[model samples]
Target: MTTYDYLIIGHGIAGATLAHELRRRGRTVLVLDTYQTDSASNVAAGLMNPVAGKRFALAWRADDFLTAAATFYRELEQRFGQQFFFETPILKLFSSVAEQNTLLARSADHPWQNFVEELAPSLPPAPGVRQDFGGVRIRRGGYLAVRELLVALAAEGLEQGWLRRETFDWNQLVVGPASASYAGDVHARRVVCCEGAAAVHNPYFDWLPLTPNQGEVIDVECSGLADTQVLNKGAYVLPLGAARFRVGATYRWPPFAEGTTEEARAELSQRLASMTDQPFVVLAQRAGVRPAVRDRKPLLGVHPATPVMSILNGFGSKGVMLAPLLAGHFADVLEGHAELWPEVNILRYHALYVAARKEGGFSS
Candidate 1:
């Protein structure tokens, strides 16, 4: 039996990146995942923005995340011999005068100045884009071919003999004070759960504030649309080719339904229409659940009672930007070289874990 140094569950962005970092450090690792179709990482458009939302507020640690992501993804592309990261400016078309003012205030003279380019005379008419109110072009933004990256990572992991393509069976998992094992055969010194949105159902860590949000995106073929930049309104139009674009992302909360919905399709089409009157044809639609947290920060750290178990999830839609830096931090913590950042550390939710345990959610 191989006693791996670390066992990782789920091969989504969080797991793959962390595994890559660990392996780079010469650690023996094993990763188990089925790579489910509904996994958010597969469907996500992989948009990375420095300043977002109606308020045009800067993201937390925006500079650090973008810098790390640029370096990390480029490294992965070179190592895997494939291109997955696309660097381009995101043109944010304003919807209202208030939003235009917000952009000016955020970019004119703020720490966010470097990440934004305020439009001159604002709202210049593009070939096929509609910008009623002025907009701003964000400099530190891009897209990642998320599914392709995973495929490349999977191939690399297989060739390296560290990956198993199978669903993890918790029923067969046994954890001790210092280690964890699966089916009484697979063994590792520590287990890190990177199970994406499914972590909400994980009995060991369900006590934490891991909220799931379902998002949907559609691929379309619209001729004549500019292919150099990503256009944004309420939704975004990401250019994939000369005549191909990926528009998406309808947010559905609560029930967190599986698969796609007709309502989502209509909503997406309407969003596209709002941005442009282009007569594009929908090629495909994909939906996945994001492992988001109520606090809008990631979840990381070891379990309260079981030091053998740890979690690295809750990235939500910002997975592309957040995964790189956070993974490096946790990997450093794992190697005893550093500690987990307080804001993202799962220990902050230890009280909730204990409360849920007392309420009979799971045995300690």
Candidate 2:
């Protein structure tokens, strides 16, 4: 039998970040992942925007999240000798005068001062882009090459004998008073599930309001577009070097399948057309499901009945920015150095789970 301090399921952003944080604290950890092709982290554009939406409101804890994420990704780049993070500005094109007024108001506020900057008229027009109502430049924003980063991290973990490629079987998980055993071969003090949308089928956590949202992105090659910064209007167009760009995405509830759809392609095409008049060749289209929660916050902490089992999931679309900070907090809680935030704690749904179990909605 093999033993470790913790066993993590799923190697998406959440699992990978938490595993790294735990290992940095000198804990013995093993990560298991099936490498699902349609996982959100694998397909996400990895955009980190502090100010989002037409309202130009600041994201929750924007400053803290951005600062922590910058430090975390930079350290990983140095450790792995890979360049995956880029600090690029996001040019948010205004669609109407109301939108411009919103930006002006936010720029004058204290909190938004550092992140929102007004572009000067001296700057040249973005090639192949339309700026009918002008635009504002957003600072401290960029995209992460998520797939590349995961591949590098997985290679490192495998080299260290701490990561395995395999499907996790929940039926084989046996939780005891102080520890848990999996597959009758691996034992650990704790088992943390980062299984994304797959958590809907997990017996211990099926009671959670995990709504899977399907999204799609299109990869296109534009020959003459010169702008490298991210462009956003109704949708985002992210440059991926060498005249290639990634544009996405559409959110639909109850994602029926894991494949791309024509409806999504047309939606993305319309959004791309809305941003620019440039001609481009469509290289590819991809789709994935994001695990969103009813409360629109992350779900973290231990199971009420099983102290040896825990979870870190439901980050939705902001996983790229939120994972690093929340993972560190989870590590601290695991080490008994801190506690889980009330809003994100899984204990908030204990009553719901209990009720479901009593009604035979779930099996023990």
Candidate 3:
């Protein structure tokens, strides 16, 4: 039989980050992951941006999130000796003068103004690209190598005797008010679930209003495109290491099929064709359901009824940016060193679920 001070489930960015934070605090932790065939972290582009979309509003808690995230990743990279983050400028191509004006006007007053800069007026026209709409450069943003980081952390955890590469069985789990345990020949003081969309099946924390959106990205081997830049035009064309680029992220409110759909492939093909002049080969296609909430915020904290069981998910598309900060906060809360952020605390969602249950409507 084996015992640990803490147990973490799932190997996604959220789980990996949390495990690292706990380990740094010198806690004996065990990470249990089933290595699900379909995983969000494995397919994530790991883009960390302070702003997104047409509105160009600042990402929620951009300052704190970015600072904490960058610092966390830098420290981890130094410790692990791997490149996890790269500060790349994102070129957001505008569609019309009105859009560019909207961004420029907001840039003056927005906190992320420094991130927005004007590109060269003599920028050459790109074939199959909308050049009439000038582009806005967003500095201090870039992508994380999500898969590599997760793998490295998993290996580190294993070497430290803190990783279990197996499926966690609910039947062997005991949930209590102050602590959780697994009774199947192994024991742990506390168990935290980081299972992405599968958290829906969790008996305790499933009440949160989660709108899972499915998205897909395609890998293309293209040359002559700028390096270390994410070109955003509706969908982003990200420069993957080597000469390959990732073009995608088609959002489907409710996923139609379990895997990549033909429609999505065709849609991506069309979008990529319009993004560059060079003939690109579609190397691969992948999909994952985002665990986004209605308000587009993450859900973190202890379970209201089952305090023994806790969850750290709902990172959605911002997992890479939010994980480092939220994971540290969560560790503090668990260790009785600090409190949870109200914005991300699951209490509000639990309240909404209670109200909805009384009204005979689904919580989400």
Candidate 4:
């Protein structure tokens, strides 16, 4: 049997980042993934904005997360000889006078002053864009080519013979006091589940309040759209080169299945139209389910009852920025160097797990 220090399930941002971090720390790791093309990480536009929401408030832990994410992606670029990370400014268009005023006021505030700046007139104008009230230029913002990055990471893992392309069966997992064996052939000191939205069906973690959300995005060929900066208002218009842009996304709760819908396409197209007058042709549409949680925080750390089994999921839409920082912390916890953050610890749902067990069973 092949032995490893860690066995990770899923190859999305969470699993890929964690595997990279653990391997960097000299751990023997094995990654198993079915590599579903419609996974959230595959379809995500990878926008890493420091400030978000219609109110222009800074994202949670924006400073720390942005700094770590930037450094991590840059290092990955150097290592892989690829250009997937783009550090571009985000042009946050104002939909109303109140929104613009709120942004201006916040720009002058303490922490916001560091990242928020008034849109400079010197910047090239976005033709056909609706900017009657103008917009603020947010610094320390950018995007990663999530799909490309995942492909590169998976290639490296495969080349090293540490990544397998297959579905991981939960019933095949045998958890011991200090180790777990998968398929009765692969043995690992610990198993980390990063199965994304699929974790809702995981018997070990189904009780953790994972609310899978289906999100859709469309690829459009807009000839006149500017690629200088990411355009955002109600929806985002991310330039993907070749006169193409990725416009997304519509969130649907209780997603029955993973597939694109006409409703989502219409929603995205309408949002895109509201943001710009540039005529565009929709080239393709894609859909995936994000591993969202009830509290909107990432779920991490070892399982309460099974010490050998752990999790690093529930990143929702912010995986691009959250993955690197959280992966480092999780690796530290796995190495006995730190503890899981209280808010994100799976132990927070211990009572729910017990209740489910008592009630005969729970449905994911």
Candidate with best TM-score: 1
For model 3, the local distance difference test gives: 0.79
TM-score of 1: 0.97
**Number of clashes in every candidate structure?**
0, 0, 0, 0
lDDT of 2 by residue, 87-161 (tens): 899988888777766665656554766887664322358788878778878899999999999999999989988
Model 1 collision count: 0
Once fitted onto the true fold, the runs of candidate 2 whose alpha carbons sit more than 4 angstroms away are: 119-124
What does candidate 3's lDDT look like per residue over 113-132, in tens digits?
A: 76676643224565445456
Clashing pairs in 1: none
* lDDT agreement with native, every candidate: 0.88, 0.88, 0.79, 0.88
TM-score of 3: 0.91
What's the true lDDT of residue 161 in model 1?
A: 84
Stretches of candidate 3 above 4 Å error?
A: 119-130, 353-364
Give a tens-digit lDDT track for model 4, residues 1-364.
Answer: 9999999999999999999999999999999999888899999999999887866667888999999999999999999899988988888888777776665665655466678766532334668777778887888898999999999999988888999999999889888888989897899999999999999788878888898898999999988877888888888888899989999888899836559998888999998888788899999999988999888899997876778888999999999999999999999999999978898898888898888878857422
Q: Which regions in candidate 4 have their CA more than 4 angstroms from the true location? A: 119-124, 360-364
**What range of 10 consecutive residues in model 4 has the weakest lDDT sum?**
117-126
Tell me which residue pairs clash in candidate 2: none
How do all models score by TM-score? 0.97, 0.96, 0.91, 0.95
